[model samples]
Target: MVTFEYAPAPESRAVVDIKSSYGLFIGGEFTDPADGASFKSINPANEEVLADIAQAGVTDVDRAVAAARKAFSQTWSKMSGRDRGKYLFRIARIIQERARELAVLESIDNGKPIRESRDVDIPLVAAHFFYYAGWADKLEYAGYGVDPRPHGVAGQIIPWNFPMLMLAWKIAPALATGNTVVLKPAETTPLTALLFAEICQQADLPPGVVNILTGAGETGRLLVEHPDVDKVAFTGSTEVGKAIARSVAGTSKKATLELGGKAANIVFDDAPLDQAVEGIVNGIFFNQGHVCCAGSRLLVQESVYDDVLARLKRRLATLRVGDPLDKNTDVGAINSAEQLTRIRELSEVGEAEGAERWSPECVLPERGFWFAPTVFTGVSQAHRIAREEIFGPVLSVLTFRTPAEAVEKANNTPYGLSAGVWTDKGSRILWMSQQLRAGVVWANTFNKFDPTSPFGGYKESGYGREGGRHGLGAYLVPSERSGR
Candidate 1:
């Protein structure tokens, strides 16, 4: 085979300027934490220090909750839906204007490729806001009954996978429905949330309407357990989601969670081989497979399993894993060292369990966290790799002899977040879609998300949807006059 070299096409780091240290955004101002504890956010691609972020404690959480409550009762609640929508529209437009800066900042902090940050994350963030903005005044017609009232203060905690996009998912609906927010971004990726605070200020949104707090799990616990917070929204691990559910138990507070998954991507014999290969690669390797809805499990029909695996391996070889700022880089670094360790440990377990592991010949960077795209064949239903959510660029392949066996294997997991089915037969697609228990089912494509589409999971994957008109219902309570 002949070799060809491609030139580097890097995105400019000058687009984003990081501060040496940052405080929490509380009541529309950057405030120092009461305990003075802070942590550094690093670029996972190079292990470069990005910023020192404040670690919110009980005191900080109290202040943020109070501010959110005050805003909800005093300003946001009194504001007309039309005016609230105007503010959200302004936020959406400002996000679009600063898209480059936000995308660059996201790539640096989250260790995702600039290509994904710029093309997928930032655009969807702005689009989410825009989509929800128009719903502010139309809540009466959203099938939630007429004159649905806001849920007071909403406490939102999001993961690091898609920082800005997740924030948009939690915040846009809350604000559009007139609920003030106290949002805590994941510890490793809080920079974009802070920048969003500046956007809220630029939009001239009322002070205390939206607050950004930064901290670890304790801070999240404090925020979630606060008595004043009327609603809670979380997107993270299944373990933490269950903990949040326990924390909110016996309280009047409503909660919505988008948790982890081990989604199965099923490919049948008559499926379009090339397209299924692309979907399988995109399913498991997109964003280095940090996605909550990633298709980490591959279920292929016995007749064409070899062909599908061959095509998938060839596709994985072409993926470039390097600098996240490189515009052409396909797979970026892992989000953090801790996550890399987990991936390594899990892959080792898979090997010990007699699964066949394979990775393309790709050189990982020495200075930062990196994991090459990996796939395990001969994965049985009993293997740990097949049942667990590795949440990395790892795929587990299992063969099935019939559609019944495929559906049985696909729905065998505790998770019901998302799944994909690839087949040319229309009846099989519909049958699989109906039989699979996941919340979202992709017939031919994988990892496609839209602001208008409702996204969530069932079973241990947590509850409640995060987008579309259904998402608005999470932040609203019907008026007594509705008489439901």
Candidate 2:
């Protein structure tokens, strides 16, 4: 294997001034943890300790929820919807202003390539706020009837994979609908969320309208079960999501869980080979395949299966796997040591179950957690890799002879988050889309996200949409209007 080399520094380090230690953002101010417990946030790229992060204990969680409740009752909920919208617009502009710095910080904290953070994640984060800001004052026309009520204090928990983007998804809608928030970012990727707190401060948002508590799973648990919280929104693993669902069961709190997936990217015999190949690559390799809705399973028609697999391998060979800061790099380091172990174990299981695995000649950095882009052929529906969510830059290829068989294998999994169908015939695309059980079905593309559209899943992938007007409904209570 050829060892890859990269620039010593790529302007990412000097762009943002990272603090030696970070405190929790509460009541529109930075405050130390009540219990004084802390953990080190590190760069997964090189295992360098980035900063000391405060661990929010039980008291801290209580304080955050209290702060949110107070804000809802006193300041936020009482404010006119127009005024609330002005703050959101200001925050959106500030995000655009600090886009480069936020992108660099995200790459440093999260192990995704600077390209994705700069282009996809940061842009969507800003767009989401901008999109929701427009809806703040016009929510009465949102099909929820006139004068819908806010959910009060919303306790949101975001995953490490897309920290800032997921933060926008949860916060924008909640605030636009006149709710206050106490959110907890994932332990490994809390920097961007803390930075967003600073953005809120810059926008002069009312104190306690947004509170960021930093910690691990226990902290998230406390936030979910916080009695004062009126609603909960989370994006993470399915197992943890189930625990959260159980925690809020029989309670008045409403919860929306955007959980796991093993999505099927189906390619018909008539699919444009070039475009289909790119879709397949983008489906699984984007974000190192950490997306909950990643198309990890490739279902190609048998007639073109060999051709699609060949093109996929050739394209994978050209993918650059190196420093995230390198503009040319396509694949970056894994998010954390723990996640790396999970990816490796799942890949090993695929091999042990008799799937044919292949990887192009590439080199991984020695100092960081990394994995080369890998694909497995000769995979069956029974294989663990096909059945489980690997959540890595790994693709499992399976073939079908007919559209009926394709739909059967695609819907066989417990997950129904998202899927793709690629074909030249519009009728086939329409037919396949209607037959697929996923929430979002793309005809000729994959992994495309927009702030104006709703995105979520079915079955084990969890429920509740996270975008568009449908997302706004999750944070509001319909009034007793004549028609809903």
Candidate 3:
């Protein structure tokens, strides 16, 4: 096992002092941008300046690509699978050891409740590394045939929703399979990804194996279209996902996308009502409902529709909404002013399109971006909220009379990223799981995630899986069988 020591930086209540101007991570070392330009990353919770992150341009991306190419050819790809597993295992341990620090940084940067960052995101990030580490030397047992080879340099762009987890998902498997990577984190939340650069140094990962470029959409576009990048992996909106697909069309580079969703959290009459209610709230209200796989659409059985809605409203009223760093907080501020505007606009469309809107009787913070937990009932199949991805703390309730109707409404959209089913009967759950077209289906659970499970979408939600053995396919090239 690889060994490294971390001296915990003393905790400070002062928020902005922890991070400053961060440079690019190229060849496992932090360096200034080629053009010397930078962009400030702000805390959306209060608009405080978090850090001035490097604004990587085309030249920076080119240098990162060159470094990754060298690493893949000279060092990373040539490592034995057992040796590769050691590095992943080392990273996983380091993450777990520093879980507290990472969790604090995540809450400060992304405006998620500290409880969630500490409990959910950080643990899962570490879990992902552990799960993928075990697979490094066992490729022969995976469904993919023997002698799998690395795709020289992978180009990846991840959204702000789950910065560190997405980074782990992209880096762990790519490294485990002997491929080097060039990654760009979203402009809004670059802090955690930069912290990951420090972890790479602490773990003594080889130079040029993992590079992080911090910038806006333009930087991501350059990485995606660059001629030298061997593969592209993305997690973002469906509109941008389609654009990436079209841009890589007719090219030799491999591409995989994990995009947006409007998942259906179905509630059968026979389901545990209290449990289903909790799942419904969590499915939509978690992360301010910014999750791509968020169960934004609630399909309640017609018989208990009113009772379920009443219980759900009462539960929403009890949730604590406040500062993201507050240990007791349940909901947190919106990620950005821009995201707030999108949520407001889509909500307006829902009302204009004839859905009845309701919000809990809760006072929002006087400053920073905030929105109350909202629900819209009487929503028809044609409303924009029913059709478009709101990406906020909003829910649209539609009732179904039978299992067949639930399936029909659940699969109505262009997205098939994830779905949730709630029922007491094992056979009913199994049958519903098979009929649902999402890449991920949760029976009696909602918004559950693990590093070992493959996570991605089908249809317009986008293609390719990001976790499990399937993720390795995006980073590998198979040699044709000799017999064939």
Best by lDDT: 1
Cα RMSD, each candidate? 1.0, 1.9, 5.9
Task: Sort the predicted structures by lDDT, highest score first.
Answer: 1, 2, 3
Tens digits of lDDT, candidate 2, 201-318: 9999999999999999999999999889999999999999999999999999999999999999999999899999999989999888889888999999999988988898899988
Could you give candidate 1's per-residue lDDT for residues 319-362 as a string of tens digits?
99999999889999999999999999999999999999999999
TM-score of each candidate structure, all chains considered together: 0.99, 0.98, 0.96
Candidate structures ordered by TM-score, highest first: 1, 2, 3
Model 3: colliding residue pairs: 27-208
Q: Rate the local accuracy (lDDT) of all candidates.
A: 0.94, 0.93, 0.89
lDDT of 3: 0.89
